[model samples]
Target chain A: MENQPILSVRNLTKKFGGLTAVNNVDLDIYPGEVVALLGDNGAGKSTLIKCVSGVHSPTSGRVTFQGEDVNFSNPIEARDRGIETIYQDLALANNLDVAGNIFLGREKEKSYLGGLIRSLDDKFMRDRSAEALESLHVEIPSLKAPIETLSGGQRQAVAIARAVYWDAKLMIMDEPTNNLGVPEQKKVLELINALRDRGVPVILISHNLPDVFAVADRLVVMHRGQKVTEKKISDTNSEEVVQYMVGALDDTRKAEVVG
Target chain B: MTDGATKNIKEPGKNASKTILLSLMQVWAWVFLACLVLAFIVAVPLVSGSSVSFLSVRNSQNILVAITPVLLLGLGQTFVIISGGIDLSVGWVMSFASVISALALRGAFNAGLPLPLAVLAGLAMAVVGCGMIGLFNGVIIAKLKVPPFIVTLGTSFIVRGMALLMSENTTVIGLPRGVRNYGNESMMYYVRGDGGGFYFFQKPELTVELLRRMDRIITYPVLMTALVVAVAIYALKRTKFGRYTYAIGGNEVAAVRAGVPVERHIIKLYVLSSVTAGIAGFLSMLRFTAGSAVIGDPLLLSSIAAVIIGGVSLFGGSGTVVGTVIGALIIAVLTTGLVMLNVPSFWQFIVVGAVVILAVLIDQTRDIIKNKIGSS
Candidate 1:
């Protein structure tokens, strides 16, 4: 309880013209904990995370990461600062192989001709990618197979492997279990637990209540662009969470603002 | 985890063989090319009887020379197409380069510059001028977020007009005599004179005996083309720049998310295409010893056709420079072979069009097969 929060969002607000996507949401993520952000469709879960992950600029608020004020202009800046977001789309280039995607933006290169020519170090990258995937107990027949040829679960594993390889301080996953087979969904939850054990704070966004109950230490529920409730895992069950998700319950009784 | 473990125990061998088969399918362009050569060898002799030879070394050299311009343009187009873009301006950019290089050479000669310097100036002017045109295309296409087809198409017209106006809609001639010799000169020439030695770096007068004896004639342009092709193949396959290109083509959003400089990379791809076009333009001028504004006009589609036939998908994200080489060779051989068999020139279009369609059909089949394998 005495540890300083690794990530703190103070009074964050984001609007798309007249439609306010995320409204004055303040949250803190401590190390080694999985905080599940649960909400219905268009409930602003994605917008709030996007603001923190640098996909979109917040209209008003301050994001403090690791005890420093931070505002990132793009996803790359956030990534460089050790914040990795696995988007809903998975954001993998289908044409590139598993190893290639693992080393996508930051590729290892060997220079020749006194640095006049630089070439991708495919052997080194492939070996490293293989090690990373192996550590995660993820298996694909070939590291050289393009991502598009991999199963959905395999692609998701590759995305997670990339984040793991980069040594992310914080992991943000949007709908990590969506469209995945049951066992694949189980693997992802286990991955979240594994990441938490490694002292990496994870912000998990999901519609699946069982997934939230199974792994998260705390739950933050948002409804109609505002935080509806925050609860510890022991204090709340799925039915109560669903009630909050459907806006049947409001923790902040600002009645006039309730949609 | 257990499912994966079980699958892994059984799937590796199956997966490896399936992947190999898939890659073989992707390389159908090479197989098609070999078949075309074989067909020509078998068919040409039967059609022409004793008058023509399709498998002769001389004819092979001629085919190589003929493929030079198309292959160069196709090499450039291969990059653009693999990056999920098309550069319509390349044809006119080539025309522009030819015209500009010719005019610059003539002016350099008029200014009494030495032949080597004049040639260098002409080559530099052509490359730089066309590169600027490519830069312009890249800016609008990448920064301005204009679609490549529309932007390049617009530039193609402007460049075509500029080429016409600059050359006065005529062939720009009056190049120095050495320019002609430089274009025609070979790396080595064999002469059956007194013990038959090889002539190195010299363009001797062709007597009947020398012509008959000159079996190994490797032109300067051919060697230059080979070097260019080699460098291009290496760049596309081995460099990070090449990886970014494929990534951008595969999924631009994903590439951006991965921290790739997508805009800058796209610009580089367009520049690469234009530079190749520029080189093609300069080489064509040398081959003819004259530069005409319209020299590359008819070649635009053929170059694209070669890329298509070589298995570079118009949708982008997958291709190889070696495939483009095979593609160019296929077109060149088809045209040359048909001519040798006394088929009318119009038939070349029919044959090439059919081959292009066939290539696309094969590409689609590859996709369907890959999907099946991937899903399984």
Candidate 2:
């Protein structure tokens, strides 16, 4: 029961007009694990998880969450089932404050009997968001500050805190630390480790081998929309992951596919 | 902050100055509008001459009356603009409303309907006309996902043309006295000059007869206009719909991803804008005792201009109705001041156009400063 996968994707494929972006990729994400999805640009790693997170529907495939086959038309529907996707853009409203952005769609309203009007309980949301950040040890300058005013690391922290607070069972983060400074990168890796400590399943899509090997329990490589290799982080080295990433693994098979 | 500098606040003096200047820019949104008001107060008197006080009670009334329709239309545009869209048809929607009410009142008056009943019918007709246009705009823009500029522009022309055709390109005049009374009736009156111990800021206690003898007066319609502005400001700051407007306008895609019903909210915003147009029409028709197909044409761009000057971003996410009210008032002041200064009415065009451009320039400069501060 402890080893069972929390999320499983079978034969997932996504086609954009003529080209197949994700072709027959399969992944099993177990609870309490950080599975690093490593690939070169356009290797279909991002597209595969976007499918699982409901950013895009699979062209032809199946996704099972907690043993139930599901298809969500949008991120909102998937979020209802405890699947959250943190896009590369972060997707935070720049005009809204940190608390407003966090509780945007799922706002908390004051409930004191019934009334004709329902409004956001500002103090409640702000306090809780403060708590959310504090728990993750992420120090934001101000909860009332416009999100655009924050640093790159701060913005990423806000996004992750939102996902964590929503009770997300499976989280798909696309390059969580891209463009972040060295210290900021360390903070993100610590967050990934913390998620593992809480027994939450995380799918980290990254190109940085150092960051990937630091937190990921298993490493999965994809090339040209196909899964090239999968190995436990302890069972493989950075050199092996690189070979699979650049399509340097299994020379005979690569020649046959190319020809 | 560097690790060594973290313990010393003075080490980041440059960064501290940037924050100071950065926050000053944020405060400029309100100060910009205030400066416009101050300009109205200072320059109106400067250019208009000492004998003709621009701050006179009667002139204030005139300013309020002039800006009522602009403010009414502006309130609607503020909602739509905040949601990352614009209603170019609003000015035409007001004309459409005016015609509907006037024609309905005429029909009832001719058919021997009672005066009160005729007025009610006219108001009903205006409401229904505004509702229908709003729904049409909403459906095309929200459901069909058409760009709002194109959709509203097309509708503006169509509605204005329909008004022209229906009115035979002439004025819909001769509205019933009952319908006109509610709009034109002065709710209260004040003494007409700057006298009887009635200084601009002084409130003197006078006998009833003395009050009656006072020559200067401020009218009820002006008070009602302020009432509308006050209510709109309140609703915007304290309601769920208010926050959603900013949310929707700031980043629509983010709003959608967060589960906001972006399409439905936008539809409601259009509906609200048209209702204000309907009200403006009813009142304007009463004031004029007639309506023409071209009544709202010039106001289309002017009302949008008022909003932009008020500090609401043309880009759609960040602004307040309070700013918009101030904006409409500035145009009223600018136009009224220029006219009193004996500027040619046609050249008022260049003056007003220049102000709009100046406003856009200021908005852009503030944004540039903000981005520099943010990146720095």
Candidate 3:
């Protein structure tokens, strides 16, 4: 029972008109584990996570989160149910401030006399958002400037902090360390390890093998929209994982191609 | 160096400079607009040899009074403009409202309803009618995903044609006195003469006539314009709807990912724009005492010009209604100033065009300067 996955997927599939972006893949994430998904470009890593995070609807599949079967129509629905996705671009409005980006749709409202006049409780949101950033060890000098001014790594940290602040039980970070410089990249890797230590499950999808090896407990590799292999970091090396991701026709995929 | 020490050495200085730069950009737009208004006020008196006393109470009241309808339309235009959209048809929509409301009130009074109630009904009908046109503009722009410029421009022509068809291109007259009074009413502080009299054109000035002249003070239309601007400021600055509007305008895809109902907010924005146009029309109809299909013809260009000149970006997402109101003043006062100084009427258009270009030029320059600073 202790080894059971916290979130389970059964034969998840997603298609865009004539093409199936993600084809019949089953994956699971357990609490206190960092599962790294490895794939080349267009290998459906993002699509599979989008389906689970409610950015896209699956064609046919079952997603069981924390032991309950659920369907999320949008990100808001997925977020409410304790699943959060931080896309590659971070999906933050550049015109708004740090607190605003964090609580864009979920603003705290002030209520009077049993919920009469409800306006944004701006002071509360500002203070709490500062607290949230502090918890994640993100040191933004000002919370009032637009998010666009922040460095790439700082932006990534804010995105991660927003998810954590919302009580996300499972974070699907797509390309979390894609374009960061060495120092920033190191900070993000440290952040992931810190998140894992706090007992939150993370599904890190990236091509950066060293970073994956540094944090991920389990590695799930996909190729041509199909799961090629799954391995524990202790059992295999990054050199072996690349063989599965490169579509070198790992024995399992070759079986499907031939049969 | 240790990793922890390296992390401790953060770039707080760069962040502090950026904060100052960002705040400056926001405040500069308004400061620049105020300077434009001030420059005009000061220059007209010096340049025109007092043909226009640019800052006199009566003259200030005149500019405010004349700009009432314009300021109203400018408020709505600010909303549309801020949301990364433009509504070109608002001018004709106003004309449509004026014609419809004028016809309704006159007909209602003729049909034996009390004059005040009939006037109220007519105003209500005008607002409702214009709001519908806005809704039509909204549906096509939001759902059909047509560009706002084309959708609103096409809708403006259709509404203009409808207003003409409603009156057969005639100017409706004999409006109810109450409706007309709304256009004409004003408040005044009577400056009682201290028994001083002067001769004018070889005749002695009578104190009774002087008191009567003093009795007429400031007009109510200025106050009305102030109220509209105030309400617009409140709506855009102090509400949830406004925040969502800015978010959508700034980055539509980001707003959607954050769960803001983008299409719905945009539709409401269009409606707000048209309803204000309708209100402006009612004001103009009262002031002019006639509602013609062509009454709104000049308003479209003036209001849009005012908005752009006020520093509201055509690209959307960064401007204030307060800036917009000042833009309206600049245009209205310039027109009045030119006419008073006996400048050719056609020259007014050229100056307005030049001012619009200048405002945009300033905006782009500010952006470039900030970018240079950012990189350095």
What digit string (tens of lDDT, one per residue) describes model 2 on residues B1-376? Answer: 2231101123467667666765766555466646765666777677766667776777777888888889889998998998889999999889988888889888987999998788778778887889788989988899999998999899888898888887888899877666555565564545553455433433345777666655333334455567777777866775667778889988888888888888888888888888888878866876787876677777878898889888888788888898788778778887887787778898778877887887778778877877765665
Error of 1 at A175 (Å): 0.4
* All candidates: DockQ: 0.63, 0.42, 0.42
Residues A31-123, candidate 2: write the lDDT tens digits.
Answer: 999999988999999889878878899999899999899998888989989998887788888888888888888888764458655657889
**How far off is residue B52 in model 1, in Å?**
3.9
- Candidate 3 reaches a DockQ of 0.42
> What fraction of the true interface does each of the listed models get right, in terms of native contacts kept?
0.68, 0.48, 0.36
- The parts of candidate 3 lying over 4 Å away from their true place are A16-18, A111-118, A249-259, B1-52, B189-208, B215-218
lDDT of 3 by residue, B1-376 (tens): 1242113244668667665765676566566556756776777777778665666555666777778888788888899988899999888998999899888878888999997788777789888999899999999999999999999999988998999999788998887666656666554443444753333222233567664534333455566667878877866775667778778878888788878888988999999999998988877877887787887778788888888888788888777888888788788877887776678999999998998998888778777766655445
Off by over 4 Å in 1: A254-259, B1-24, B190-198, B204-208, B212-216
Worst 10 residues of 2 chain A by lDDT: A110-119
Estimate, for each residue in A1-259, the C-alpha lDDT of model 3 and write its tens digit.
4587879999999889989888888998988889999899888988898888887889999999989998899888998988988888888877778888888877777666897545666777789888987877778756886776677777887888888888889988888898888888888887788788878899999989999999899999988888888889999997889888897747575677899
Per-residue error for A143 in candidate 3, Å, reads 0.9
**Model 2 residue B153 CA deviation in Å:** 1.5
